[model samples]
Target: MYQAIVSPQEDKFIAVRAGQQAAMQLPSAFYAELADLTDSDGVVPDWFGDAARQAWGIELADLPIRDVLMVRAPSVLPVTYSRASWEINKGCNFSCEHCYLEQRPFAGLPLPEKLRLLDMLRDMGVIWFEITGGEPLIDQDFVPAYQRAYAAGMMMEILTNGSRLYRDELLQTFVVNPPHKITVSMYGASPETADALTQTRGAFKSAYRGMVAAAGVGLPVEVTLIITKHNVEELGEMRAIVRDLGLPFKEYGSISPTYTGKGTTLATQVPGLIGKSEVFQGCPAGHTSFHVDPNGFATMCKVGRDNPISLIAESPQGLMRLPAIADAQMLRTGGCSGCKLSATCRVCRPMARVYQEAKAPLNHYCQHGMKEEP
Candidate 1:
């Protein structure tokens, strides 16, 4: 006997395992046809034989199968869970010249407020939650919030400047219940570069120590380098540091030209970083993830928080309205449509603001747009 099942796209032939061949009473022709179809030179891959046996408990040799072609409709909703970021605090201990979170002061959400929001998120089936701030650890309520979120079954991630994660207690907590991942922004090559970028003398040392501490606790760490005019030429050095530390790092070509923090003098001193052509463009915010400001307002991306789509409220009804807001913004002129590189671009809202302010064409960053091929 032969059994056939239809998948969403094609037909699948199932066969009985070796010992069950006699028990199943399958015909000899069934086994021969299956063998012919699944032979080494046959259309199906050899691995499929094993897969069919495991899935259907039938040997490919005993199952005769045919795959019928079918047209499949595109899925309406995306498959994976959408990610949402929450700005737990706006204040940072180190003020980097290119800091996008420059508008707000450093502070953690109140304990009561944080708990309420976590509960709401849990009820909404939010699996990915990122806790960020000037330095999220700076907030006294940080550890409790992490514990609560973990208990609620949320896979948490933290984005930090990495200066305050060196405490032994914090390191142990991270090891005990590590977030899905932690991103530490590596400022520069040496103490001077780190200090110059952060405007804090000991920040680089602290951040390096934090990375080592996190590693000791067996937590996975990813390093991020914000490439700017000052650091653009040091990509090789940065890569070496990542290799030496045995950590993963990504270089985000500088997306912001205006420094939002206190060190306006240093911010103005650095020249143009990457040109517009170098930035990959598609706004994947609504498609994959989104950012929520400290005040609970939803923004398309984390960089630009001034324009909000909706507020994160206590009720589920309010949260449901977010997609429409994202859709509306996405259709607008300056949101994701202006750039020629929009299809491949990782353009964020903050970068959009810079282009709007300068009244520059899609290529806001001159170097990326104008550089000659090496």
Candidate 2:
């Protein structure tokens, strides 16, 4: 992996340390010079070495260009973006009750097609790439796909359950390439509660082992404590486990229906946590970033997956239609249209639509939900 990445962010340019947040802005002339030197396989310029050392305290004065820098080419596409999330596959090793994916099929594009999709993402100037799934680590092509994105100077993040992270090969690859973040969900503190929640024997043992292994290597791992009725009793123990591992964690108590409007998953949501989310603030989901499904279908985001554009058929050109699609889907229609509480509504239009379709009780998503709380 390269030491740093010099890339375009909107109209300006920036140089950032690999897998870190340390960044320095560049002048137009400086970025122009770097662009001109893209093909030159020589030493990193003396000026860059000084800037990097000053900004991030890294030494790179005499390193070869190929070794020190991955200079990303500016995107020429009309619909340019700097961030995206991809579902490598919807398949997972464990069957969690709170999973939002109604169908977790173990299928996706072939390796070559996956590579082509990654290249297209690179060409679109996407730098912050999130690879998630029912569990991303379980995908067969995850490593190569991750490597390709990392080589393209994208700061990668993986969303997984930590079940498969104990594998030596996967751990070594992560240590070497170094994702910007690896977010894992902790089901429970013990095997009985966690395994019962996931419906997989030894689920807690495997997940806990993986977390320990990742922590031992000092990988950038963060835990998410999934709070459901099954594991609610172990909340304190769960927090203690993550604290003992010296890992940071956040709680997720408000579960939602499946994206396809199935309410089965919502049954796992904590009653007290319902309607606790922050009021609806506008998002930049399709304007500045988007999501891609396993089969190369691009959508506004995971929740508002209406009128998906086939990235395989249109390639990067399909993204040109996303902004308008996002706007259309975000409009407050159907049950939420012209409501008096629209200003204080908690969920987005697409999300509320799903809950309405699922026939969920008003106490789950509506502002009326808060009023119903006794």
Candidate 3:
């Protein structure tokens, strides 16, 4: 794999080849994208943007120039996936209030079918799998699915609320085979609060016990907290708890509305989050990253829920054609075309229905001037 290390301080770009910094510089073609990337303040410091513009003939001369663009590998890289995430089933033991997934019947793939899908994923060039679910441990065929993927030479990860990891077979399987990481979600800092949040009595103790037990076996473990009003003040304490468990790292994310694509839980969102005003990138679906439901339907992301890229419907040859299909479907059209703030706008048509109060393309949560396009 070739790696181009770009320095924000200077135009110094070097490509790493064969584990060494190859004498080759980033080919001149990547400069403009690189510059626009660094100048997120909407300010291009130097002629890098210009060089990129002239080289690439960027029509949005309105966009930027001579900058050294970073040619990032797409999610669908030749030999590896940027990422792949899936929920084997919606069956979870601990029910949390902020959960995006509502339960469907336990209709996940069977073990043989799962192995077939795993083989298909390997064929499709997925390098790793982030296997998550209502609780992946609750899924009957999870271990077989995981082991199959691993045997097929793919890296694997599991996301759980941590209730069932302490099981001997699971603990040993992970200790011996090991995953890239096992990320556990901590609902709250204390037993009462955590259990209260999950609506499952004793779930907090079970989760912590699983974390401790997994770490005791030397498996890589991480804990993440989804910031919500209920646990907002307990962030530091949660970090401390994870630290006490001696997990490798901790992370946090903002609470999102229920993910059934209905935005039914939109009212539960914590507005106090200090969010960034970052601009839009391209559609993540059907491209760099993809999500597979238990049913083998694929999409660029779990959110859009629009175009269904049915994995079972496609042959291996058909799967290769997906990137183009994804790229074509990723465009923003109509009112989204000429909007200057399109870069910063968060609302898209799919989630627009979630925040369906306003029928316009504007983001209903906009504290900025995004409501009305000038």
Indicate which candidate wins on lDDT.
2
Misplaced by over 4 Å in model 1 are: 1-81, 232-235, 257-273, 276-288, 304-314, 332-354, 358-362, 365-374
Better model by lDDT: candidate 1 vs candidate 2: 2
Per-residue lDDT of 244 in model 2: 98
Order by lDDT, highest first: 2, 3, 1
CA error at residue 21 for candidate 3, angstroms: 18
TM-score of each: 0.67, 0.94, 0.70
lDDT of 3 by residue, 254-364 (tens): 444555544544444555452333444546556656778888877656665555666666633444555665665456554445556555666554443443432322333
Task: Order the candidate numbers by TM-score, best to worst.
Answer: 2, 3, 1
lDDT (C-alpha) at residue 10 in model 1: 12
Global local distance difference test of model 1: 0.59
What count of clashes does model 1 give?
A: 22
Give the clash count for each candidate.
22, 0, 24
Candidate 2, which segments miss by more than 4 Å at Cα?
Answer: 45-47, 372-374
User: After TM-score superposition, what is the CA distance of residue 332 in candidate 2 from its true location, in Å?
Assistant: 0.6
Per-residue lDDT value at 56 in model 1:
51
Give the alpha carbon lDDT tens digit for every residue of 71-147 in model 2: 88889888788889999999888999988899999999999999999999999999889999978898889889999
